[model samples]
Target: MVTSIASVCLSGGLTDKIHACAAAGFDGIEIMDSDLTVAHESPEEIRALCERLGLRIDMLQPFRDAEGVDEDLFADTLRRAREKFRTAQRLGTDLILVCSNAATATVDDDAVTARQLGELADLAAEHGIRLAYEALAWGRFVNDYRHAWRLVQLADRPNLGTCLDSFHILSRGHDPAAIEEIDGEKIFFLQLADAPDLNMDVLSWSRHHRLFPGEGSFDLVTFLTHVLRAGYTGPLSLEVFNDTFRQTDTGRTAAHARRSLTWLADRVATTDSHDDRRIPEAQCPHAVDFVEISGADLSTADHMLEQLGFTFRGSHHRKPVRLWTLGTARLVLDEQDKHETPHLSGIGLSVDDSDRASARAEALGAPPAFRRTHTGDHELRAVASPDGTQVYWNDQPAETWTEEFTGGDDGDSSGAVVDHINLSYPWQDFDEAVLFSTSVLGLDAQASSEVPGPRGLVRSQVMRSPDGVVRVPLNLAPPTAPTPPRHVAISCQDVIGVAERARARGLQFLAVPANYYDDLAARFALDTAFVDRLRRLDLLYDRDDDGEFIHFYTPTLGDVFLELVERRGHYDGYGAPNAPVRLAAQRPAS
Candidate 1:
């Protein structure tokens, strides 16, 4: 399948967008009209650059408001179309996208619209160009793909056909199965985009909130399957109009866009057995083996862990790394890198087949990470995440690696297990990280939420394995706020007991405001003694119909923090409602 992206989905001038798309492995690009209009290069120069970069100019978009107009208006629209057709010819592309009138339409009759489109197609044919008419979701008269297809049929022109955009069709709740009924040859172009479910106006949502496929709530596999079933073998192009993508680095955004298409193609191929292409099945991790922290000086982290009930498991014989554990939660502190500051650096996942997981990640364009180990070591394969965090896969038991530690297996067991890991990313890396977690790491993205912070709103998305063993909550720091550090949460049967013991051991907890207890009293009918205990220990509480969640945080240790949680019953959430209070309390005072 040919992969393509619209130039409008990235930042920079026309030439820069083209170069980025080519470098990212895209086969072609749909050149947006505004990008070309503002570019310094002539159409011939743009064509030469695409050829030099081994990229094709798939389409010159969008010639808008061309149909459903009076005769005088139609004549002027044809004049505009003629100019664009000349430009398309010079740019070495044969297709032009004409979106249905969303602005000014003097006539609403289908016959008139069809006739005007036929006239425009006749004008386009003079320059050896084809017109792919699209219906915007907010178009004045024609707002559905079915309507647009009927108009294409009515026009009965060889050069005029309907363009199917997933956003315009699915955003309005239209059935996509009907696409199977349309002739494949009549479908001139196919544009794909996924988006979060929002209750705002269609125009605003389409322009600002559109996410790439597999990153949002759209059923793109089914959507693509139906299109393919109709025998449409054209390029699978992306036409996302996101505010963030438009302002991000053109090369990085293009790379992310390319990954999304590769993931979507693999998904579609997996669902259809008859398809020849097959990608590796997604790996399901059974447990988190360990979390590795690295820095020049990790003594402070070692002391903090000891205070929180973790017992030393001794240092690695061949490397400058030490292990600490609280029940099944293991922490590996690596001090080999003397130049780096304290940071949460790596994670280890236990899957059924580690080799297969590493191969799948490599197939999806993730770079392999290598580590120095002795010949007797149980080699762990790893890949670097988009945020520079290393993720290692291991199928062997803990004893295989634990035996390498000098101090032996006599460490304290605090009855705690890793509940989840929280990772914060800069605004630019958020979507790319989401795609990486879902496609490369084989995790499923749950519903996301926005939490209010001191600087602005923080967007959070949870990605987890199907069996609920592994969970990663990805936080996108507010664009205007400084990026926050990452943290880990460990769960125990009795958080109150653990907190009491840690406090007695001199572990400093993040202070809770006095008003929090009063608010908690108003929200839930809890015993006064329980509320008082929560306030005294700086604990936070949240309850849903299924269960209750109680948790508390420790003060930041360099760029990492810790949270102890107790989950009662089947609490599936991460206490999202309490996020604002936590963020506000964590903010530094002026």
Candidate 2:
């Protein structure tokens, strides 16, 4: 299956967009009319560049509001279409896309629509151009793909066929099963986009909130499967209209789009059981082996860890790194990256097979991250995530890597294990991070929520493995905000005990305001004594029908923080209700 992305999906001039698409390994691209109109290069020059870059201009898109108008308007539409058709010939593209009119279409008659489309097809044929008609989700008359196909059938022109867009169809909640009812040969193009479930009108939803495959709430696999079942074999192209992608780096956006199509096409291939393009199956992470903090000096972090009940495990034999462990939770401190403050720089995940996982990452275009390994040590095989964080995968438990740290207390009773990792990303990096968690690590993305914070609303989405052994919450920080601190949440057997011990060790926790306790009491109707104890220890609390959650946070140290959490009676949440209080209490890089 050849992969392509629309020029509108990326940012830059046409040359830059084409180069990024080619470098990102896309086989083709859809040249939007707007991109072409604004580019300094002529159509012939753009075509020559794409040829040089080994990219095919799949289609010239999209001629909008081309049909279903009065005789006067229809004449003007044809003249405009003729000019675009001439442009398509120069661009060396045979295909042109026409969108159903969302404005100025007074005629609701299918016969009129079909006749107008047929006339437009005749004009396109004069230039040897084939037209693919698509139904915009908010089109005046032909708003559904089924309706668009009916119009195509009525047109009965060889050069005219229907183009199916996943967003247009899925956003309207139309039945995708009807897609198979159309003739395969008549389906000329397919555009794919995934979007979160939004409550606004379709036009607004489409222009601002489209996401790539596997990053949103759409069932694109089933949608694509239906298209395949109908025998549509054209290139799989992406037409996302995300505001973030438009503003992000051109190369990065193009690569991210390519990865999404790869992931989607691979899934469709697996389900359809054909070898068009093979993507390695995901290697679901089994456990978080360890998280590493790196800086010029990590003495402050080291002290914070000890106060949180982590036992210092000593230094590595061959490198300037040390480890601390509390029960199954482990942290590795590296005295490096001298230019930056202490930060959560890397994470090691225990998977069933490291080699297979690394292969999957490579196939998805993740850049390989490297670290030196001395003789008789585990090779530090890793990949850099979209946000520059290094992700290391190992087949063995973290203790295998911890073996380098020779001297440590073996029998600690801290009763703590890594519950989840909270990573805050810039606005542009959020969707890519979500896709990374889904495609690379095989984690299931849960429903996302927004928490009000001091700066703005924080968008939170969690990606977790099947057995719930590994969880990573991806948070979308506000646009104007600075880089948010990343924290490691450790689930303990007893939260009050842990907080008391840390307090006894003279560690300053992020203080919770008194109003939080009042709200908790009002919300849950908890016992006064339990509420008093929680308030005294600065602990935040929440409860659902399933169980209760209690957690506390440490003050931010450099760009990192620590969280101690305790779950009672099968609670699965991350104490989301307490997030606002935590946000208000957190200092701004003090």
Candidate 3:
């Protein structure tokens, strides 16, 4: 199946992020609720930006602590949900993420939580929206995908679905194979994120240490294989919440995301074709529809997607990340700089036998300077790509490892299979990149494209193994947009609630125009009360059968910004049409 990423994984403010995702080659984006909260933009304005950026708000996420609360708290949450649903209807979005009750939630009853969430889901369905129930890495209860799925089953609401997050699921040492037993329809959204193997708690790790896929110990290929085998055919959104990525350059971060998704897609191709548990290609879902990459240098990173043979999909020119395309999969590159690497950093893979797909990379020549670490279910090995980029490969799986050590199945899983990689090259090295990828790396050429921008046009290429099992994209930008920036996007159920909380928490925000909403009311026949409420909250919107997609914009620090969104109906796209409005909003007041 294809891979995707959540925008929260990246760093940067909303206005500049859409450009970042488009540049990174991601298929779709998961708009974080927090990002939108930071932007005091109206719903119509936000919708206009997504339309301009050519991105789909695949899932509006982060409905926090809705379940298992006291009646007073639950009622408050219900009110918040209603507001979010209203915002979702304006933004043309559909899926709302309801995460497991956090430590702040006092109730310890899973049944109560399930009932509460089911009630919310039923209410959401009335608005043509679905709630994707998720388990946090440090949730008070229901931290595992299986348990969360069971909760959804128990809820028995048609509007309730499961969100399979790689970090929460694999980080807890849970078996991804449980995916094989789940019905694909029940699974609505798949949020993918990876982290280095470290001796830390899941909560801290998720918030502080999450890296891009292939940069950590999670066996995404195996995990996704099980997911696809279960008949899941949805976008796999990346949701890395790292501190380092928050401060890096925006373009570079976007490029890293493009490369990571390319790598994950290749790994999926190899893993799904394995003989031990091979499934028909038709049974499997399409490759990643979108991804969110985090780290600095996002702008240049987006330009780098061309090197990987990814096309400029589209982006929120006013947001932090850019979206790019490699075949059908989408990659979103972000640069949060959350105390993470500042260079072209991500996970990488290489194998000796092309037949058996290796989840971790095997050194073809001399091993580079690196070390290994252990997480809950996997082992991570770090190495440099041909260009001396920092890339990690997970060497172990959960089922085969013991409590103390992690190891890889070199015999069965190791072979000369290349996962995927995205790398940046100097403008002068553009031709050299082609030579290096095709000759030195012995990879087959895939496709090539160029993108235009204020800076100028950028060029790129993709190289894959002869069997098309492995892929890599190398990118080069002209002198105009030389530096990359950091960016990120996150999905959530309620943008208005997040915005209210963020404001209450004393977070600064970028403002939008009231005139935009005045015009919006004339175009769409929305409930006047809802329109007035959105205008008062400064939320933005767009519409489709998927629902209304809502968004917000905020400030940037160290190349990082945050995005928040809500999906109400069946909409799956970045609000591209909102670009001009967002850009104008970002402009200094006259």
Candidate 4:
């Protein structure tokens, strides 16, 4: 689960919200609709910025009150849904959040609400979107995962799904066992959060006193175990709506989040290792696609990962450098010079053993960057990556560990696994880059290919995990063409899925030329209807002998533009053959 967190759920709209979440150790972020609008940042701009920050927008949120509304209100809601859908499209996302109807809900009949939700589901499907209906604790119609799940079942639309919220689920006195009966696929989003158990209502408690996982009393371990047992494979977001968290130091808060999530993860691993009376690993078919790394500098990044004793995985073959998969999670290092003022190139890592994993990495020569000790508390070490990135590992006290490290935090975003990363290098030093990656970082070199360009050939290499779960492309600038650095591709099971979700979140995409699709139809022999659909979506296409892949290109921002991709099979290579075609399309008319 790429640790995702709700936007407003964290702090505020400032980069502080991002910084806190990152610092709190989240892998992806869920931008509330108002966050983008409030910041006066365009969806396209946010998409670009997140891409730059190395974060994924798990879901565009607060598509509240979609069901059980009057006709006029429903129309207005649907209109907003369409706008959010387009935002999702531009953001390169696939899930949109639809909280249960609140204020404007004119109707209270669950049956009628379910029917209306079903109609909305069809509408979402038309845009290739999934509506994850969250049952808020205060919601009138549905306020629990079971109730929401029942509603989803009633809707019966493929694109209609439920969101499992840790706060709401556990706060209502629901046990993890509630997850046992649900269909995993129908649970599109799982939100995990922890709060200091109090006498107040769970919703109010969540908004004021929620802590990171392991820091609270909720049985998140049981909850997450149940979620995993139910085979609910999706991103686990840390959606804490806490007032104190808003004022907490960004870096400290992020570190706490990392530690909390890591503790939960360790517990999950142990639970999975054991055969519990309630669930068995063999019976628990669901696996975490990826864990999240939210906050910390490159050194702290190193700290967050090394403390967990995670091994370095491979990185991408194109664009500015980013690496993935150390300690069972993905670490995204923010490489932008803008934040370089704080010199804050950040890190997020998912690890098997949050503590030992990070410690071992430090032993393997990670650079120590920060330290803090209170009373008899042992000094905590933050480390820097070989590239001078900062990160820290979780060292939550043993008791807190039991409380927070429960494989369940209630934030909301999905698509937890890392899809891919793009890296770039100088043509001259490309060989050294490959060597450093394959040997020092412990990744296997997959293949090298020549990208034919107008001037000459651009050579590159693909590196991946031995199991093939990670794929990164290393691209060296051709000596002849002076193009700048950029990230060129993203991996996903469903491009249309990402597109629809991105549309909902207000993401922006670069326009692709129609001629590209015409060429695709002529060359690939794809069904005309499919080609037309791709063209309309502005999605590009390519193929390897194993299968096909889709991609998109944008003008350079910093060193690279972003690529959103859907791979159909073992087509492991970058869609190299399509390189010339895409470049031609993206290049200004000369």
Candidate 5:
């Protein structure tokens, strides 16, 4: 019922980590033995600090290589286990983590291993300590969690229970349904971690690639559901060993860890044994109501919108904002002091309830975004993303807010709508952005991609709503790299017509090299006439079994660009294969 995190998940000294965990609102922490072993403060001082901070030492980890060894090694192991037991007693934590022997275990007999563990448990019981046996993915014999539980059952000691780690279970593709077979009280501790689908050694992946709950590929909700069905009532603790988190700021990592638990609690509330564990519910947005771009002056962007046949709706009466419309698509140009280069600063999502969406976002550790409004103006409820981009939630119709503007004509737009938004985040904040978008906006993360760019590979994680009304491709760039330009892709019923109108209005399109068209002709079955047409307009094309995609990009306006796309039939992709051509073409401006 409590939320906790392991000290190995963060970067700092033992004292600093305890303070950060408490500040981040964690109930307890699993202290790594290595941290305490090299600490300046004594175990008594560390325990006093935890008491002062209102934190509990949930467990002391880890006493490794204690079982499945020779009798001589077992003698030394028993000595080591006794000292760890005393240390746990001083730290005020009654549980110690016992990972399965990864090396130096020649005995393949389960009875011998279980008997040794029982003897160790006997030693722990003398100090009023419990042992939570865990399986390591790289363990020599008992790599699976079920095997660890089997050993615990054979030991039949009240002080010896199994600990379930999500990484070890899910990474090995073990059936979690088997967890329901173990007695709930015998599940002494639970550790959760999410990791990406990798094709390397299990040990390396476990050490370097662990991510927060919603930030990676594992299905933790279902895994926890089975544990709950078994009636386990221990703390929901994070035990992520990530290379990135270890080097990042400790406070930020701790906060990120807490948010993951918040998100996960809300997700598993249906199966949770306790009602108080649930957070606010998340509602998936229906559509992107509008995208707001801010810059010193967006005059060039205004011209680009006009060329694309977007009708000028008008300007805000009390603020420096203008609205443009094309069918269901809306774009807002804010003349703010963000930068000289125009970039996406805000996004408006239409949901069932704006207030509820905001509540869910706030619960997941997103700070409120700043907005200015008068007495009569429609209030925009929004939370800022990790990269400082505002995500506004709206329950009212567009007219309620658009009516505040008065000036230009509302002309026809030929049913063009926003297809997706491409947002760029620095590497340090990329994972946070992923979790924020998924947990707050209720978007499902699709398969990630790496596109070859002029500088390096551009990693794009696509987040899309269930109804396919919204798609956001989060692009990651190195922190030291220049800020990547953002783009708004508008889906038109007829991109050729839109492109022709923009061209006639004197808008310069991004010039695609003729070599690209040559490659397209060699790839697809398009005839010469269609290829020539696409080549003449400098447009890019992609086709899959479902349908075809025809898209073209506009020249960069400051640091923002516009893309017009047409999906023939059921093409659901964002022209990822053609991204390299677009990136190469925009390199000079970049």
Candidate 6:
């Protein structure tokens, strides 16, 4: 399918947006009228630039409040349409998007709206331009696609057809199955956007909170399936209006948008019986093989790992990297990168077929990551995520890499495994990271929650594999705070025992406030002795109807930290209710 994006979805000037879209592999663009009007280049020059970049100006967007107006207002609207038609001609595009009137429509009658649209269509036909009427979710009169489609049929002009925006149709809870009933020829253009469900004004939500497909809660797969069933073969354009996307780097945002379309097309093709062969089948990883941290000095990290009962599994035979293990948990510390601070830099996932996973990631626009390997080392296929984290896919045993360690697993096993990895992203990269986790890694994004932080709210989303073997809890801290440190949480059968052992080994755990224990005792009605034991060990406790959770944290090590957790019964949460207290404890004493 041909992919396109609206110029308004990205940051920067019209020229920058065009170049970014082209570089990101978009086949066409919906040039917002304001973007073109404000460009330094003339329309002809802009058109030439798009042509040179191998991009088509698919549509000139947003001639708003054009129909269902008074007679005099209709005359003025017609003049505005004529001006837009001239602009469209110069921009080398034939279609202009006319959003159903949101304001200034005195005549709400459909007959009048249809007649006025017909006249506008006749005028557009005279200029050899087409008008794609879109029903805004908050339109003054025509707020539904069906309503807009009826008007388009009533107008009955070849130059006029309906533009179905996924946001408008889906956000208003309109039945998209009806779209299949409409003639494909009458459906002029399609704009797609996904959004998180929010209880807010529809107009505000549409304009500010829309996310790219696969990044939000919208059922875009089913949405696109219906559209494809209708036999509509137009460019699948993205028209997201996100506050974050508007301020991010234009090229990066454009690339992220392009990946969304590629992912959506693949999903639609796979879900339906379509013969499109662009994307490969998704490879869901079975388990996390290892987590790699890199730094200039890892002495402190080494000490902490030892205190937490992780046995040193020896350094790589060739590289300056050391492996530590506790049961199934593997932590690789790479001292090869001497310039970087301690950070969780890479993750290795065990999949049935590493090559297939790598291929799928590359197909979805992930950049392949290069790693130097010795003759004895296992060659891992890796890809760099949007935030520069390397994700590696490995075979189930990964013996090639595991056997390279010389120590031969001599140290005591702690009986702990990686429960989850907490990764923090800047506000700008949060959504992109979500998409990457879903589309490239084949993880499912669960419902996101906002945890209270000292500075502000921290949005957390958990992306996990189907069998719950691999879980990545993504956190987005408020921009005002310093970037949140990434952490790895290891789960033990007895966290109390592990905490005591670590304390005896002289590892300083993050102190919990006494008031926190008092509140927990009141909240969960825990036995006083249990609460006292938790407080004494600096542990946090949380429980739900299903089960209970107990966890504690280590002091931050540069930009990384560690957590030991114990989950009882069926407890699936990450002790979210205690996050504020944990944050307070992690904060430096004011």
For each candidate, the alpha-carbon lDDT, in order, equals: 0.90, 0.91, 0.61, 0.61, 0.90, 0.90
In candidate 1, what residue range of length 10 has the lowest lDDT sum?
Answer: 273-282
lDDT of 6 by residue, 26-93 (tens): 99999998887788999999999999999999999899999889999999998888888999999889
Best to worst by TM-score, what's the order?
A: 6, 2, 1, 5, 3, 4
In angstroms, the error of model 4 at 354 is 15
**Tens-digit lDDT string for candidate 3 (57-83):** 777778888887789988888899998
Candidate 1 C-alpha error for residue 380, in Å: 1.7
Model 2 weakest 10-residue run by lDDT: 406-415
lDDT by residue (tens digit), candidate 1, 516-589: 88999999999999999999889999999999999999888678888999999999888888888888888878
Candidate 6 Cα outliers beyond 4 Å, as residue runs:
411-414
Candidate 2 per-residue C-alpha lDDT over 194-301 given as tens digits, one digit per residue, 9 for 90 to 100: 999989999999999999999988999999999999999889999999999999999999889888988887787888786766777888988888898899988998
Report per-prediction Cα RMSD to one decimal: 1.7, 1.5, 26.5, 27.2, 2.0, 1.3
- The residue-by-residue lDDT of candidate 5 on 85-134, one tens digit each, is 99999999999999999988889899999999999999999999999999
After TM-score superposition, what is the CA distance of residue 129 in candidate 5 from its true location, in Å? 1.8
TM per candidate? 0.96, 0.97, 0.50, 0.48, 0.95, 0.98
Question: Which residue pairs clash in candidate 2?
Answer: none
Residue 263 lDDT, candidate 5, scale 0-100: 86
In model 1, how large is the Cα lDDT of residue 254?
A: 92
Query: Could you tell me how far off, in angstroms, the CA of residue 358 lies in candidate 1 after the best superposition?
Result: 1.8
Candidate 5: Cα lDDT at 46:
93
Q: Considering every candidate listed, which one attains the maximal TM-score? A: 6
lDDT (Cα, tens digit) per residue for candidate 4, span 1-590: 45777776545564666666654546788887777777866777777777777777788887877888878888887787887788788877888888887677778887888888888888788778888988888787677777888888887998888888888877878666978899888888888887655798655786677666654567778888888888877787777776655654555455445445555654576777532321111111012223222222344443323322233443322212234432223433433333432222332223334455445333333336663333544333345543343444443432221122223223213343445555666553354344334322334666467777665676677766565555557776676676534453445557776665554544445677677777777787789888887776667788867988876553344344446667787776567777766555555556
Give the number of colliding residue pairs in candidate 6: 0
The runs of at least 3 residues in candidate 2 whose Cα sits more than 4 Å from the true structure, single-residue gaps closed, are 411-413
